[model samples]
Target: MAQHAVPSAAAPDARPATPVRVPVREILPWAIFAFVLAGVLLYFVGAEQGATSVFGGTWIHEFTHDGRHLLGFPCH
Candidate 1:
């Protein structure tokens, strides 16, 4: 009969786990970029129609038509 070896509770080579450090300085630029992008998207989806449109056409409104209704902007 062959005997199986069991692992010991106190392993010698195991190192302590450390929490991941997030570099805010590195992330700040991208965060600001994303914020600006979100603002532009919100403008297109909610208010890109009638008089306050950047592009002078109904195409932008039609493109984001369903999105307006979905986000409860009342663009009818």
Candidate 2:
């Protein structure tokens, strides 16, 4: 019987291992930034410009006023 020794060599540099990407850890700051941006856009867009509301019809008017009240904004 003949015995053969195994060769131990590093992998070829031609094909490198894929790099691992990690997500951002500080997401709260980004979320706050987005919230502020949306508010600024909404302010410039003007809420009263639209006749149609998400609530629809008479319920829409009531819902809008109630939402404003809940948010501490005086609509009426």
Candidate 3:
């Protein structure tokens, strides 16, 4: 009678994952820029209209009409 060897149940490549460090100084400017950009977009999509209009005419309203309705801003 011949005996066969059984395989071991050891795990392979069990290394821990290291977290990357993000510095605030490097990301502050970009964050601020993005914030400002978002504010401007919000204004255009939500407010840019008559009485509170920055530029004259219905062009801005027409341009952002769908966006206004999409954002739940009443244009009509």
lDDT of each: 0.88, 0.55, 0.86
**What is the RMSD, in Å, between candidate 2 and the native fold over all Cα?**
11.0
> Candidate 3 on 1-76: residue-level lDDT in tens?
6643743345365456799999999999999999999999999889899788998888989999998888899987
Badly placed stretches (over 4 Å) of model 3 are 1-15
Candidate 1 deviates by what RMSD?
Answer: 3.1
Top candidate on TM-score is 1
The TM-score of predicted model 3 comes to: 0.75
Q: Which ten residues in a row have the lowest lDDT in candidate 1?
A: 1-10
Q: Which residue pairs of candidate 3 clash? A: none
What does the lDDT read for residue 16 in candidate 1?
A: 71
Error of 2 at 62 (Å): 28
What total of clashing residue pairs does each candidate reach?
0, 0, 0
Q: Is candidate 2 or 3 superior in lDDT?
A: 3
lDDT of 1 by residue, 10-55 (tens): 7675567799999999999999999999999999999998878889
Q: Once model 3 is optimally superposed onto the true structure by TM-score, how far is the C-alpha of residue 31 displaced, in angstroms? A: 0.9
Give the higher-TM-score candidate: 2 or 3. 3
TM-score of each: 0.82, 0.30, 0.75
